[model samples]
Target chain A: MLSIKDLKVNIEDKMILKGINLDVKPGEVHAIMGPNGSGKSTLGNVIAGKEDYEITGGSMEYLGEDLSELDVDERAQKGVFLSFQYPVEIPGVSMSNFLKQILNTSRKVRGLEELNPMETLKFLREKVNMIGMNEQMLKRSLNDGFSGGEKKRNEILQMAVLEPKLAILDETDSGLDIDALKVVAEGVNALRDGERSFVVITHYQRLLNYIVPDYVHVLHEGRIVKSGDKSLALELEEKGYDWIKDELAATV
Target chain B: MQQTVIDINKEAYQRFDALFGSFEASLNGQKSNPFHQIRQSAFEKLNTLQFPTLRHEDWKYTSVQRILKHKYVLEDTSMTISSLPEVAKMPDVDAIRLVFVNGVYQSHLSDNLNQVEGLSAFSVEDAMNHEVYNKVLSSRLTSEVDENTNPFFQLNTAFSRSGMFINVDKNVVIEKPIQIVHISQSGDSPKLSAPLFVFNVEQSAVLNVVESYISTETNSENPVLNTSHCFYNLAKQAKCNTYKLQKLSDDHYLIHDIKADQDRDSVFTSFTADLGGAIIRNNINAIHGDENILTNLYGVLLGLGTQHVDNQTLIDHAKPHCQSNEWYKCILDDRARGVFNGKVMVRQDAQKINAFQQNNALILSDTARMDAKPQLEIFADDVRCSHGATIGQIDEDAVFYLRSRGLSRRDAMLMLQLAFLQEVTDFIEHNGIRDFMVNNIVSSFEKIV
Candidate 1:
């Protein structure tokens, strides 16, 4: 469903991603584990068509179509979602109204009829309840004053609402507690379907305990140095990333 | 520094002189009243004072040269009420509407004034003879003088003989808002419509007033100029809310002046929304007459095409324990220009005062301009006063956030613009009026896009 071949990215004359390659089939969950400054989040942002990074080499193909020419919104309309590590706070825009606009716009792009206020409320209430969020949060400004966990949950809620084909969770478990992490993982697991794919980027394997991955890849120095099964996550958690670094140094 | 001398427009002065003669003739028997003397002095002052130039600090961003070049007529009795353009009335508002054609109050188009209890609404000429109105007018006329030298205000006072006066009785709350609609139909001639409105809210009374300016001359080669003045006096513990909506045609110029005096423990709020006009200038001033008064001045200006909207506001905190908050936002598109000059003054004795002023603008086009100057002059040491002014394009981060959520670039930008305006529109106490204003702002934004 998604393919990245030898991706080299730079931002303001500084290289963030040197060379990266990843492939994901439909219904597959891929976890990308990396230490700090390993460019895991950059890959997720580039895949979501963020404009800040410059793709120096290679290409990204989503559903067999080149994504370099598409805008952020166009990519989103085509069912690509990125759950930000740090969500933006937009004041004066209520959460529900923001969601309704996005849902209606996406629907319009897909040649579907728009939902009215009542229909939108019903749909939002169901998703909101499933995520165990307070109804009052929907009336507040979109993530304006929300806590870190609340923002993460709001992001997951947006993911469920948008129902993207390819969802990228960029450190979604970074600032969440154990209980919050389980709730988020459960939310993500509930939305998983046979046709949807996810690329979860994280530094630790604690989140993998809740939502198991089909494949685990260790990203070191902007390159995917190791690829293995879900057992790799448990091994990394026990042995740490020093073994991977030592192996890379020995090969060099 | 050498003092520069301003040359007044001779032709414009001649035209104003002839119009003033006509205005005096229209007054007829009321020429002997003391108010007529005030009009004569104001006319004299207007004649002596030259039109403000770019050298003037207050008129730096705006120029009256185009408006002064035309020889405007005072009265256009040739046009009938049916010839005026239709203004969509707000739905679900049980308002008492007073319609005026060419600055002349049209009783036929107005609702029955007798239905309102504890309220006396009449033409200025008729109200001058009543004892209650005379008492209020005599005391307010002296207090109503403009603090600054503005030629338009003097000109409006000179020619505004046929105006309206409303007096609310003590402890009476007017359930329905009084809607004053001023429609200018200058036909082919470049006319000047000057209307003066006076409102007196007695002690413990509550009143809501809305004044809307509109024009009907769609094909006139020369632009019509409408200069209107409204004076509101709120007595002790009274509450007054006034809204001024300027939606004239693009071929017109509007100068609206509103001054309110708040007595002890009274509250006064003014909302001015400028949607359309070639050149629109609103001068809103408020004064605290006694201790513990609250004043709010909020406005929104949406300018498109070559529109020019200037808002000059002053909140004078002369009494102790008074609080005033002022917020004005503008959205300028195309080559439109917006100007905001807000001043807050805390007198020496006005201790324990709180005053805040903010002006924000979004310049949507390369040629669009915004000039915002927020000034605070506090003579009292024990006061909290702050002012802020921002002139910028749309927030790029906010735009990107909206776009990333599936909105197009244009929709995202428009949504952010509306959100910026919503900060000021949320201050409207009446929901119907707020919605109407928001809808108007949205439609205006659509035109800009």
Candidate 2:
């Protein structure tokens, strides 16, 4: 569903991501674990077609289209979702109105009939219920003045509503409590159809316990140094990223 | 500095002088009555207070050269209209409508003043004969001449014979808003309409007024210079909210001035929405007459194409324990220009006063310009006053955030701008008027994208 080969990226004049290669087929879940400044979020943003970085070399592809050619909205219209690490406050735009716009637009782009307000409300209410958000939340500004957990829940709610093909989860568990984590994980797990894919980026392994990954990749200093399965996440939890770094140093 | 003897735009000033000369000449060389004295006094004052220039500190950003170059007929009487224009009517508004076409009152199109209880309305020329009404109008007129100090104010006063006088009795609340529609239709050449409106809300009375300035000639080439001066006098414990919307031909000019006075324990609020006109200048002033008064002034100016909208507001806290709040926002697109100068004055004796003023603008195009100047002059040691101005482009982060959710870039921008404007438009206290204005505001922003 997604492929990246030798993707070297620079933000300013400074290089951030050296060479990187990744591939995800349908229904596969991949967890990218790394410490701070490991370019994990940068990879997520680049995949989502954020226009800040310079792709000096290499190519990123999604569904046979060059990722860089598509705008942020075009990629989104094609079912690529990036759950932000810090959700922005969309002031004055209400939550329900915003969601209805998203649902209708996404549906229209997919050659589906746009939902009427009533149908849109019904569809949104169902998903909003799945995330356990109150109906009152639909009236407030989009994630504005919301708690950290509510923002994450809102992102997850948007992902469920959009029903994207490839969803990049950027530190979705950073500020969430264990209960909120379970709710978020459950929300993601519900959308885990056989055709959908996820690349969960995180700094810790706590979230992996709820949303178990099919594969785990340890990104160290702009490079994915280690790749393993679910037990690898468990191993990293018991030890640490330094455990992998030491092993890499010995191997070198 | 050496005084250059060739110091004025003499040609432009002479044209107005010639117009006034013809107006007086047509009077058959007979100038009688106190009202004519008022007009004559204002005419003389207008020469001294000629049109403001760029050198004037208050008129720095905006030049009156366009107004000066255009020739106006002083007042247009050639309009023989049968029906009111559709744009003057607000959807679902049950108002006591008063229609004035080319500054001439349309009796057939207006509500009968005698039928409404606790309400008195008359033409300004007729009001001069009524003893009590004359006092109410002159008190404000005399003070404006002494203190307001605006050239447009003087110019409008010279032609102040054109408007209406509305007075709500003591302890009475007007059940519905009084809608005053000024429809500008061009005459033979270019024309001008300067109507003076005075509204008196007596002690403990409540009044709601919605004023609309619209042009019947939509996109016509012959532009009109329409000037208006409205005085709102709120007696002790009175409440008044006056909302104005100016939508005219893009080549037209509108200079509006509003002076409001709040007595002890009274409340006054004013909202203005400028959607059209090549050059629109709004001068709004509110002063506290006694302590414990509250004044709130809010506006939203939307400029598209080459439209220029300027709002200059002043709130004077002359008494202690009074509060004033001013919030104005502008959205400028294309090569349009917007200027906001909101000044708040707290006197030394006005202890414990609270004043807050903010002006924000969203400039869409790179060539579009916005100048926001907020002035707060506070002398009281115990007063609280904070004023700020912010001019910025649309928040790209918010735009991208919306666009990434599958919205087109245009839709995202329109939504963000509407949301930005909603913060101020939502403060309209009346629900029906607010909804209508907000809907109009939405449609206007949609056209921008």
Candidate 3:
């Protein structure tokens, strides 16, 4: 579903992501874990075409097309979703309106008819219910004064509504409590169909227990040093990230 | 700079002298009327005070030199309101429509005046004959204004002939709104019109007044200048809401002044929407008399092309426990310019006063400019007064968020700009009026890139 070859990224003359390579097939759930400042979130942002980072030397192909050629919105229209580490708070725009615009835009881009107001409302209600969010929350301003957990749930609700082909969950479990984590995981797990791919990025192994991943990769210093199965996350949590760092230092 | 200043003042005086001669000739036997003294004083004041220059504090950001240079004939010809464009009428809302053509009242175009009990609507000439006119006019006229402060208001006071006089009796609530429409028609000649309006709300009365300004047959070379003045007097426990919508042609100039006085427990609310004009300036001032007064001033200015819009507001809290809130927003695109100067004053004896003022502007183009000045003066110790002003472009992150949701870049920018304006437009209490204003705002966005 996605391919990256020798991905090299930089921001303001400082290299963030060195030469790195990754590949994912259809219906595969890949988990990327790393400590702070390990460039885990940068990979998600670059895949979503955030425009701030400069791809010094790299090639990202999504569904056999060059991803760098498309803008952020174009990428979104083409079934690419990035659940932001911190979702932006847009004042004066209701969540329902925001969701409807995105869904209709994506549908139009995919050669589908746009939904009317009533139909859109119904669709939004179902997706909102699936995410276990209050109906009142959808009517409020888009994340203007929402709690951290509510923002995460809203992001999941958007992901469910859009039904993106590739979803990148960047730190979606950072600020959530146990209950919120369960709800968010349940929401994500419900959307896991046979054709959709997800890249879950986190700092801990707690979220893997809920939405178990098909593969686990440890990112250190912008490079994937190790790749394993879901059990690797439990082992890394029992030990610490320093063990991997010490081993890399000894190997270098 | 000095040469241009001297030339502007000289031409202004020459034109005013010529216009005054024609004005006096039209008065005929009414020269001996009681208002004649007031007009004479105002005329003398006009001659003594030169037109405002950029050196003046209030006129620092705006210049009236171009408007003063035109040779404007006083438009006294009366035309039927039906001759005006259909856009002049707001038909969706149930209102008592009073139409004025070239600053003169058109009785044929007005609705039935007897529909609302205890509500009196009349032209200045007809109201002058009534006994209550003198009392109402003398109660608040020229109480808070002078020639030194606003020369255009002085000009309106000096030459206003056919104006509107509306009064609501005590304990009466007018169910329908009263709309006063001023339509200017200048045919191949630069025209000038001065229209004054006086509104009196008796004790415990409730009323809403809407003033709309529009023009027909506006010529670029022969521009029309409309200098309008309005006075609103609210008695004890009375509530009044005034809405002014200025949508003139691009070649026309408008100078609007509104003065309001509130007694004990009276509430005054004003909404000013400036959409189109070459140069539009709105001066709003409110003064509290007794205790427990509430005042709200909301304004929205949208400028395109080379249009210039200026809004200056002042709220004086003289009584104790009075509250005043003000919010003004502006959207400028192309080479347009906007200015906002809001001032809140809490007097020495006005203890426990709460006053808040905010002005925000969004510049859509690199050439567009905005100047916002929010000032607060608190002389009382037990007062809570705050003022804020922000001049910025649209938020990039917010725009990106909308774009990420599949909106085109243009639609995203427009959505954010409309949201910025909704903060002020949402204060409209009438649903029909609010929707009409929102539609106007949406259409105005189409004119920009």
Candidate 4:
């Protein structure tokens, strides 16, 4: 469902992501693990069409269409979702209003009728229950003073409400406690309906145990140097990322 | 041949001088009235003081060249209006409506004074002639005699022919608000109207006043210039809330002066929203008469196009244990300019006073400008006084965050801007007025950016 061929990206004059290639089929979960500054989050942001990074070379395709043609909002409307490492705290827009706006706009773009206020509330309440978020939180501003765990859980709640075709979780488990991580993983697990796909980017192998990726890839520098089944996660967890750096140096 | 702004201003002064003569002559038998001395002194002060130039610190950010370049109809005859303009209508607000067209009170459109209990309304002539009301107007007018006095207020005092005198009896609470609508309209040249409003809330009384300024026509070449002033005097333990909504045409001009005094344990809260007009200025001053006064001065402004909104506020703590809170927020876009100057003073004997003042501004366009100055003077030994000013742009990161969630760029910007203003509007306890103001402010902001 998603393909990247020799993709190169840059911020200002500095190269962040060097040449890389990857592919994922529908209904598959691909976990990319790397040390800090290894371009794991850069790849997710590139797919989400963030404005800072310039795609210096190559092409990325989703659903047989070029991803560069869509704006950030257009990409979101076309079912490309990115769960930010730090969800922004918007102090004026209420959570319910934000959720309702995104849902209705995405629905209209996808050729669905806009939900009435009652239906929207009902839809939001079910998603709220699925994520175990406080129902009263909707009355407050969007993440104005939410706890770290609550912020991560709020991202998952947004992901559930939007129901994107391809989701990118960028360090979603970094700030979560074990219980919060369990809840977030369960929320993601519930949404894994055969056709929906995910690219899970994480620094630790613990999240893989909850979501259970179909494949694991070790990103070093900018390229995906290693790819294997779920067992690779256990190996990396035991050996640490230094094992991948040593192997790359020996190969070079 | 083109005329310079200087020559146009000279012409304006000559026109004002001529109009003052007509005003004095028209007083007829009332030339010996008690207020005549106040008018004579004000006219002398007006002539002694030149029009404020940019070099002056008070007028540093705002230039009145745009106002001085035109000729106004200072001696316009009476005009007839069939009905109230749509802009002045408050459908959800149940109140006493007082309409003024071209500075003359239209009794036909206003509520009858005899119908309302514990309320007395009179014209300027009747009030100045009244023995009891004369002292109230006299003490307020002659109290401030300084070189720093604004020439516009002096102009209003010198030439104003029509105004209102409203009094609330002691221990009476006016259930409905008093809505004062100042409508400026002219079929020919730009008209200049100065109307005065004097309000006295007796001891233990409660009153709410909502004053609005609107123009029927919005011609850049022939807009109306409305120079109005209001005096609010609250007696001991009295409570008064004054709300001013200035939504004149974009080309119109308004200069309003609000003077208020609070006696012991009185509470005075003011809310001023400046959303329209080419150039508008509001000079608000509130002083403490005794101990335990609570004063709140809150203002919100949305400036677009070449519109300019300047709000100058002063809260004086003269007695012990008085508290004053002030918050002013402004949003400027498309070359609009805004200015906020808030001053809080604690006198020497005013111990244990708590005064807080804050000014926040959001500039949407790069060309949009805002100048905020907060001044605090505390001579008292023990007092808690604080002042702050913050000028910022729309958070680009917040915009990107909203856009990433499927909102268009415009929607994202509007959301952030609206949120920036909601903090101040949420303080309004009246839900209906808050919603009405929010709707109007949002619609105007949407049209700009």
Error of 3 at A101 (Å): 2.8
CAPRI-wise, candidate 4 is medium
Q: Residue-pair clashes per candidate, as listed? A: 0, 0, 0, 0
Worst 10 residues of 1 chain A by lDDT: A88-97
Candidates in order: C-alpha RMSD to true structure:
2.6, 2.6, 2.3, 2.3
lDDT of 3 at A240: 84
lDDT of model 4 at position B405: 82
Q: What TM-score describes the B chain of model 4?
A: 0.95
lDDT of 4 by residue, B234-352 (tens): 99999998888888878888999888889999999999899899999999999998999999999899998988999989888889999999999999998999999888888999999
CAPRI-style quality class for the chain A–B interface of candidate 3: medium
Better of 3 and 4 by DockQ: 4
How far does residue B342 in candidate 4 sit from its true spot (Å)?
Answer: 1.4
For all candidates in order, the CA lDDT equals 0.86, 0.86, 0.86, 0.87
Give the winner by DockQ: 1 or 3. 1
Once all C-alphas are superposed, what RMSD does model 1 give against the true structure? 2.6
Per-residue alpha-carbon lDDT of candidate 3 for residues B266-363, written as tens digits (9 for 90 to 100) = 99999998889899999999999999999999999889999999999999889899999999999999999999999888899999999999999998
lDDT of model 1, residue B404? 71
- Per-residue C-alpha lDDT of model 2 across residues A155-188, encoded as one tens digit per residue: 9999999999999999999899999999999999
DockQ of each: 0.63, 0.71, 0.54, 0.71
